[model samples]
Target: MTTLLNVTLTPDQRDLLEVIAAPWLARGEWPLWANVQHHFDMRGEDADAIFHSLPRVGTQTPFGAGYGFTLPMRAPVDGKDRVRLTVAASLVVPKVRPVGEQFVQALQHMIHLYTSRPMHFDQVPTIILRSEELEEALPDLPVWFFDVLPDLLSNEPTIITGGVHTSRRAWEREVTRSVLQYRRVQSVEGYIEKTCEIVVAAAAQYGPAIAVAATVAAEPERSPYIDAGLLAELETAAATNRWKVHKLIALCQGLNDAYIAENPYACAAMIRSILDHIPPVFGHTDFKHVAAQHVFSMKRNDKTHAQRLAAFKDIADDVMHRPIGHTTPRISMDDLPEPIRLNAILNEVVIVMPKSAPPTT
Candidate 1:
């Protein structure tokens, strides 16, 4: 017996699917029927519903009003029944290729449409709650920040005017209308949450695809650990080179954020920036010559410099070098916990810089 997996769809998703499904669907036949079974071994039993509901090719209807379709589609798994897949129409089409890329494209387009629609007052709170949940659930996932959160936040209209406008009524009707319509609050706590849930739900449907996207899109997170001692040393180091203090401070901030986000590449880049600046500050001028000397040594007074310098150089090299078309070598978060230690060591190197030369006449 063939297994059947059920896929769910939101009302809006079902409607949008109907529009895209028109080309592949025919009144007398489903063009995609053989393709889906051949490729995915899946079948949509209700193909007629889609074709029967489509308006003529050239006709137009109010956006989202005329199309209709059913969802909870079925697919087989492991030659026996398994979990239901909540697929959209985008996922339904046969020609959609290369392992779910087409599905994401379709989903993103629908997201554009969903967010563009005017939201009701009652739905705002739910969206905001959902947004917070998604943020908390996927703190390091860039998709939540870049795609989902922005969509939710932008969905709520800040202004109340110009939509389906109506004039104030005459005395009999005006006096009795609800005063609530005139009152509006600035809270967006709800709108964002609901939009977050929607995006997350879609991500869950296309888990592998979204996960890959998240990895590509993610940035470094902020580190929780701050070193007072290191910070003080950096401040003092910056005193002589006050003009360059901003760059140092920015590096520290970037490092902290990267460490927390577990972004190894970003963390390494921050280290490399400080390393590249070191030789120039003290007039060594040649990075290739002095890079190893400073990185390999601890100040004579700092006993742990040998171990720390060795460790820091090992990590720095992994992140800084790429032979060709390859990823950075480092991956683990073990070294990220104490970036301040490395920063402090770099500050020591900076302290030796000769003050700026007197201006030449």
Candidate 2:
């Protein structure tokens, strides 16, 4: 999923952006360095330094001007080490403005090239100007890093070529001819505008999905008893391999899922599994011994909870091993053990687990 990093500019930065964007706002032309110097009343050298210092968007090498800002981000790719990405966008325009289809294709081509290359260039949706009417609308230029996930464009092939040819030289010549044909039919301004529109629409459509995925990622598994934070702590402890709590974690998650689905039988079975699994953490082969002998280190209420948890095993066994009779058996949410009882036991396990070793530099 892609992440949107909102960029907030200082007052001075805002003023500087206005100076850079003035020419485009007035006449749809790229601003000159001289215009910035005149607006700021600075000398040529000083203006040049300031202009270059700013995080610019669009082609700057040949002194082309476009709206938006450059934001640098460190993000992980395909489970590998994090790489630095330089993200940029063009100026936003109203939706009513006509943008050609060819422009969208061209922009997508550029996106594919930049992202696949060693020098990562990430592009996001353009700033959208929200207004009832174009004549009365004010430009809403917000800067942000819109992370485009690799999977979003993974299906698009890097190279497009003509039909199979007998020789490599023939294929290369055919591809060159196609490229020249495409260039002859494309429009520069229309391509830029359409690219911005497509990006804006994509962001709008996928924003909610990305947010939900991010929330799920932040908390791998959650239940009433095991929240995201507690689960994280348990994971950290388990990583050391000293606690041997991986099965305990899985059981806890199973219990949570069963409880949520209102399957009292499954919930009871999961609780029994958890009871049988965590005794080793307390230096006992059986839960009954742990419950009887391990309460001295715990607080009064926690000790009571632990004892109650031990008693719950009988109820869970009855639910799991009971035989079918003439009368039908029924179970409900009330038949399950209290969430706090499990929470107390898990908390104690975390307290006793060894801390993971620190990473070496």
Candidate 3:
């Protein structure tokens, strides 16, 4: 998997990915099992159950089928069936911090698992995971962090609203003191000796190119790699770690201490891997023709009736717009806090930037 993504996902992405993968796994279609069976020469059903366990499969919409995920083989894909396919879609946001990191793990895992199981999700079927629950599902964090804290990806592109709007970041000196400081530090003091060694050695022993990369990542002017080309180059550099370079690249782009302290090797490695596999996914659109029926209702106003069309907006605002930082009992931001934040913050700083073209002829 690291060979493919090079660590494009941060922590929150891993969380979302776990939830995203739950649906298919619950249905006994986990490609991960197939992958395991292929390597270990295990029984089909036995391998299936282990890989499809509750902790793994139940991560999907557990209560019932058809929670929030969009599937291609079901309604939207096939028009011949009356009963919808027994596939459920769901993702539980963690109540703890480290938001985006979860999604990154899940994303990388799911994609890698997909290569093993081609029939379940279809060869890149029309699938869209709903991120709305995440908006209201965050833990009960204060509004202060909310203001400066970067918002995760919304319906829009990789644009984060309601923050100082930085292109790149470095571990702020303060994060070492804050709760986020414990990032990947195996030692209690919150130190990432291996991470610093790699970066310093890469800069000092390797060549001037890495030195320039190290310096540029911490630059005040959003680093010189604000352009797309340089970001790709950075990802290539980080991919050398293969385990966590994406996390490192994110850390470099964002200097949050918690993020840095944790998984310095993995982060740096992921960057290099993703760089090697730049422009990873190309989304193709799919159209569904099922559920031919249309929904119609009467419109009313003045808060007197339940069918008030005008009240739809108000009701939605009250219900749908839950505050961020809330917890998810089973899964959430804190499961791997630092990695998640690193993924989110660094994604903003590194992955989505528009690169400047090299000097043209």
- Return the top candidate by TM-score: 2
lDDT of 2 by residue, 100-190 (tens): 2322343344443334444425854322211122112212311110112121112112212323323422211112111222333244343
TM-scores for every predicted model: 0.29, 0.37, 0.16
Cα lDDT computed for each candidate against the true fold: 0.36, 0.45, 0.26
Worst 10 residues of 3 by lDDT: 282-291
Q: Candidate 3: what lDDT? A: 0.26
Top-scoring candidate (lDDT)? 2
**lDDT of candidate 1 over 43-151, digit per residue (tens):** 4333223322221111011111111122222111111211111122223434322112322332233333334556687663211123334334445544313222232
The residue-by-residue lDDT of candidate 3 on 143-169, one tens digit each, is: 222332222222111111222332332
Give the C-alpha miss distance for residue 168 in model 2, angstroms: 80
For each of the candidates, give the backbone clash count. Answer: 19, 1, 69
| Ranked candidates (lDDT, high to low) | 2, 1, 3
> Between which residue pairs do clashes occur in model 2?
103-191
lDDT of 3 at 97: 23
